[model samples]
Target: MSDPTATGPAVPPLDADVIVVGGGPVGATTALKLARGGMRVIVLEQREATGLEERATTFHPPTLEMLDDLGLAEPLIERGVRADSYQFRDAKLGKIVDLRFDILSGDTRFPFRLQCEQSVMTRMAIAALDEEPLAEYHPNSRVGTIRRIDGHVEVDVQSGPRRGTIRAAHLVGADGMRSTVREQLGIGFHGHTYPERFLVISTQVPLQEELPDIAYVNYIADPVDWHVLMRNPSGWRILFPAPPSWGSDEDVLAPDNVLRQFRRVLPDRDADAIDWVTLYEVHRKVADRLRDGSTYLVGDAAHVNNPMGGMGMNSGVHDGYLLAEILLRGHAGEEVDADLDRWAERRRAVALDFVGKETEGNWSALRDDDEQRRAAQRAAWEALGADDEARHEFLLTSSMLSSLRG
Candidate 1:
């Protein structure tokens, strides 16, 4: 608990129309949007600088639209690789099924997925923030406490050696899974971690012989391990399901271990050229309530999904776009409480219906040891790929275009 009115030598008073906690993609985008809409906005980031992790690389159609609205799509495309199609292979059957994005050319400006590192996306977002004159960015600042006052919310922020208070008409928590703001507001995030972990490895490999011009390739129904290979700007990324008892978080997945696993699944490849490798535990969860009076939650603070469908980051960016619109309307004295609620409802529905379910399905299909189940999974893919309408629907769902409002 922090005293709202206590002004000391260490505590400074800061005021803004909106206070955004977290400097990740969602928070930065929200702050930029709010400030661009004529609101004085402040962004508090706990890290001194943005993280350069290879978290997400695929951006769906709706996300591209959002990026276009933010004037970032062009630059991103300039630095990204376009994935026009995805292939699903059955190792046991020795058969492959491919789905092309061009088939659904009527729905979106970007029918294809963009394969760019998340660090590149963050850089673009930060650049967009720099263009917003009304946005104040405070790096290395952590929000210690946030509370709703009579007409405004007060946030206690600690930046290195300095502690300060920011009073704002509204607040948004986009601080991700372990959201301090969400915890302070007593929001319940209900979810569970997956039984198996995922090992992600990136390297410069030419898949022209086996996978020519293919953007995304998934080796499904493998009894040993499930794998996904995608074309990155500079190289390729290989994602595989790790055994439940692989290693602890503190232990890093060494190059040798990564190569050994690659050899097991993809034996023909040379493993000496590995770039980076990591192990991540997958989780699926969402907060009970995304909003509490003047304070709201966005991004991973609201919901977290497995990366199988690559929906987590894209969904979070969409959260920023929708929440920004609601906040803008609210700031203009419009009735937006219902709209805010609608945003949460719609996003939560999509998360559960599409993101959560798809990831779970992917996990089940990949990890199932039964030969019958693997054959069933392969049959489903082939059947879906062979039918145009079925393939379109599947593409719409997988690309996240079906989840958008008309």
Candidate 2:
């Protein structure tokens, strides 16, 4: 562990009202909200500001509305692909149905999914936080230990040459799944990991000519294999399951194996058609609780699920907003302890009941080999598209508006 008082000019004052760990999108959102509320906030991130990876590229409708409230939606929409409709298809049977987001026009001003890399949102939020006089952002900073003293939270951080203890009224862990803050707090992260891993391949090659009817987002279901094809500002991305039987990670990501996977989408394509590839395991874990006295958890620190319905990042954004809202209430002199308890319960329920179930159901339905279940799933999608009322309800849930409203 680095000393708490190492010297560097990058370090700000060793105190804040809120100290946020992990400067990803969720952490940035939390810091931005608290700073906007006039709280002294410090965001410490392990990585440099410009080095964020491209993850969680799909933004649901309510998420856009939330970004709009922060004056961030318009620029993102300008840079992203507005996916008005997304299709569910059978590999053998072709398109089953296309769920249109416009059905939610009456419910939200932005009625479409925005396909932009999550790094974009993080960068924007960090930039916005820069304008807030109360906000201090430190990149290349990794949080070490966290402890509570005298009803105040203290965080030990090492940022390049600087290492110091920062005292704060509260700490929010917006870090990723392997959150240092959460682990140090001894919070139980309970859930199971899927038997298979997910493989993502991004390509610069345009696929529209080959798949004329393909929407910006398409989930192609097969008894033996299911794949998700999506378009972001970068290019087209294809995601599919990689079972343990597929040998080691190196074997699964071999050039020949990767080309074989791409050939499934384009038979004529060669190795040159691919841009980059990655493999990650999916999980359905949720932290036992969101609060441990003055410390809190948000985003993947609180819950993680398969990225089937694109709910992971979007729901994480909602978590940041909700927690900040409740804390702001407390800052305004309201007795928010009861409200804090409610926040924990409400957020956990949203993670497990809404996000986990929906994403898992999606993954299950797409790859299910059972004829009866597949037929029922097909029928349900067909019916949803045939009736405006049913489509409205489905879109409400699909757009994640219903998740927040309830």
Q: Give the winner by TM-score.
A: 2
95 in model 1: Cα distance from truth in Å?
4.8
The local distance difference test score of each candidate is 0.81, 0.89
Q: What is the lDDT of residue 14 in candidate 1?
A: 41
lDDT of 2 by residue, 297-332 (tens): 999999999999999989999998888988988888
List the candidates' TM-scores in order: 0.91, 0.95
Model 1's TM-score against the true structure: 0.91
| TM-score (C-alpha, index-matched) for candidate 2 | 0.95
Q: Weakest 10 consecutive residues, lDDT, candidate 1?
A: 211-220
Question: What does candidate 1's lDDT look like per residue over 175-293, in tens digits?
Answer: 99999999999989999987767888887767645555344545455767567787789787788777656675544376567778777545777767677788888889989888788
